[model samples]
Target: MLTLDDFTPVTLEDRAFFLDLYARYPQQHSDMSFVTMMCWNHYAHYAYARVGDGVVIMSVIEGEKTFRGPIGPRDPAALEEVLDLAVREGCAAPYYVFDEETLDWVKALYPGLAFRSDRDFADYVYLASDLDDLPGKKYLTIRGHLNRFRRSCEPVVEEMHAEDLAEVREFLKKWCAWRHCDESPVLAEEKEAVLYAMDHFSDLGLSGLMIRVNGAIAAISVYDDLNPDTALIHFEKGLPDCEGVYKAVNQEAARLLAPDRTYINRESDVGVPGLREAKLRYHPHHMAEVYVAEKTDLEKRHQGRGEI
Candidate 1:
């Protein structure tokens, strides 16, 4: 029987293996595959799948962030094994959002797995697609914001520099303080990840844009390629002074990173009410559903409601 120990570091050979499995199942989006995220996080935690003669998984448990398995061959037994390994490794509620087939098998294995109807897992909205060909209504909204911003103040957009980190950190500290004491865990981790990305921008495959008004930074945005076809907007923050700074920064980001990518991954929305409303407003091309799974033993610890 295939076991977790058999799982190995994702190498060129493994990418070829996963790519082949992915091509065979075109409905699966292994292209934004968790394995890639594992590799980037440096092989500390991994997700695995049992396929043919081998098992596949990803690793790299940095701080509180992790991706377990989007393991394939959606058999209930195989899914359980993946979850078991995830818990044994000390990952807290390792999760993934996959096709109904995968989710069904997972639900069968854990029985307590609860699913949020939305595709995102945190309190953020993502806007994607080429800025030019964006639907008329969306295009108009963006244009309207930019026009208003143009008239509101002298806005300058420029590539971010390492020197700006101190000011950016200060601005973000103030922005985060607006949240309540009982805020979301995902949001907190995302903030930490964004800070890490900023400190090591080039190494993290990140690039950013900052908006300055009257010689002071007003808004800053950062994004990176999730894959060859998907660019992910990781973080964006605006000063309270600007009326339309957030909208203008996003519009500018789309303009600058275009002509080659098919989509953008704005990450997740943890079902925060206002965030859900905003993401829905973008009319996301579609959402990638995410989920949390626990070992049956660990499952006994919670009330088994299977939430967050």
Candidate 2:
């Protein structure tokens, strides 16, 4: 049986383990990538347990928890063991499949199970070329934003280096201080997560871009290859001094990532309306769908009815 003790925190060394698994089962979802797991471990508290020949991954925040994987290949007995243990341990939902491949596998494994889609967690995936070039009339507004910013201030895009990270750290402190990161639980966790990524940037096989206006860092974005064809942006932060620096940094990051990656995954909106609107403006080629699974036996039943 799988227990909490079996799960260990995701770290930089787990890259090889995940990479081998991912090569066998390629995925594009942001959360499935090792880079996302390691960087956001402070926020999500990701951990993994080896279950026979497969692996079981879990994420916890506050006291609530969710699970994914047994990622290698399907093992009916293994899934049954881990999930049953998870239910006994108070995981209301034991599975979150972030792509259609995993969803279909689950459906085939348990035809009677219920799978619920959550748009709030669906990752917005776009063509790297679209973001890099901002082509066509559809991108007119984005182009306008960049043009106005260019007219107002000169924007310089530089590849982030080890030497530049100290000032970048200071910039992040300034950014978080402005948002009062210490006062809000969510922001505080995110602040810590962002700093962790900065500290382990190279160890995680990551690259970043910094946008400077008038010789001051205005915005920064970090990204990593999620799979053979997809690149995922783990974090992007900007300051008020540069009005359109967000747009500028995003495009530049896409340009850097697009040379070898075909798709750019900007990750989930977390049901934030303003963020949803902003990401939608980029015109995602498709969404990396997410589904929550529940065993039929776990569904609530009324005294006189089959389901309630």
Candidate 3:
């Protein structure tokens, strides 16, 4: 009997509830993180419904509603109920599966159901050591770029502090101008999302690093623990004034996090060709794959059992 009415909008007040659930469930994807949900809530219109020991998340984007599988202990009955609700109320690609274990169970439930691989949303996860050290021939190009940047810029790296928020904001304005964020709807949304994160940095439990060139902030990376073994970079921005500033911020962040975390999730490329190529160059340890079940596929499965 779970319905849209049972779902509540994601807000700052719900952070603790989500953190608790996520601690117990341990999510693999960045999208499942509470900070991501809150920061992008305006654009995604996120909501959740608590069912039994689990919570089912739903997001409305561009007027289309899509649901993610429950984030709690594996309970087949609870999952089926959510799936039924998604079929009745959600868009074409109604349900998303983030991990392989859930995908396996969902496939078992409906042997004929088809799940589409969402390459655009797949998270690129890299070994912390690989990014921190740049030790092998595979990283020769990146090492060369870093060396060139260091020789040219002599960047001073520092951990971002509370007082740095104002300067960070100014840096973002400059970055937006360089990227022409105002001209692109997607970039504008991203600007808003990152600003929201910075505004609530402490509240969201975020840590970051800034690369300073000539005592001015040129690049910044905001991140937080996604799980015991992984750190997720929520926002990484750099000014084009310094070549390879982006790589500098990225490497510094990885070096800072590598000691404690095993992996660094740079998040998804959102199907951007250039961004995808850039992430692929890092050589991900593995992709935290995302899969979605189409409404037609779910309907067909239900129809086969005369249950729809």
Candidate 4:
């Protein structure tokens, strides 16, 4: 039986092992690393789960909310036990963000569990190795953005530096200020974590693309490898005035990552109407569904309460 001790991120070797397992899990990808990096960057209680000699899981414990990823194992009984342990040790509701196949398996095992059922968040998109041969319809808007970005700003995409942290932090503060204008709960912890990610940004599978106009940082995007074949974007921000800055960053990223991988996992939108619209505009091939699993009816009720 997997014990609580199996959940700690003991060493780099252990971390790498989990990273590898998560990547190969068919459904879970490098996004787990992104989530884990966010937790570690913020010093939030994050760890890995050793389900067996070969299986490793990533988990994050944040106050009353616990997020789990890459549901690695295929055994329903084993996963059920792990879910129970995760919720207990995590001291929060356990959640798994994964593809539809894994979701189907878990739902079959735990018939009564509930999910917020959302598609509005950032979704994963894949690209062809040949950047020159861009696809039709789906990528029309993306191409347009890149074209417009060139007209509006002399865009410059580059790896992030320690010096960029100050600018990124300032950008976030401004962005958060705008977010707060809409009564969004601006979590200081999340900002702290993002800054932390910036500090070790490169080491954490991140490629920062900065767009400059007249030598000033106007837009920036941070993305990293979610798997050997997929990249996941974490945070991307641009000044509203900047015409094609966001698209410029994406095209440049496709160029940079062409040699390394073929897919991009932008992640979910948390059911926000506007965010969903923006993601859909990008035209994702398909969205992976994520769900929360629980053994007790009380925990299910708690999940609904949080949504309310």
Which number leads on lDDT?
3
The whole-model C-alpha lDDT of candidate 3 against the native structure comes to 0.92
Clashes of each: 16, 0, 0, 8
Candidate 2 local lDDT, 1-308, one digit each (tens):
78888989887888998889999888878989898888778777888998889988988877677788788777877776666665666456656878787778766655666778889989999999999999999999999999999889888889998888898999999899888999998789889888988898888888898998889888999888888899989999999886888999999999898899899999999999999999999999999988886643333212233321
For all predictions, the C-alpha RMSD in Å is 7.4, 3.5, 1.5, 6.2
- Report the C-alpha lDDT of model 3 over 101-155, residue by residue, as the tens digit: 8899888777788998999999999999999999889999999999999999999
TM-scores, all candidates, are 0.63, 0.92, 0.97, 0.72
- Please give the lDDT score at residue 227 for candidate 1: 55
Worst 10 residues of 4 by lDDT: 299-308
lDDT of each: 0.58, 0.84, 0.92, 0.59
Off-target runs (Cα >4 Å) in candidate 1 are 1-67, 70-80, 83-134, 138-142, 177-190, 291-308
**Backbone clashes in model 2, listed as residue pairs:** none
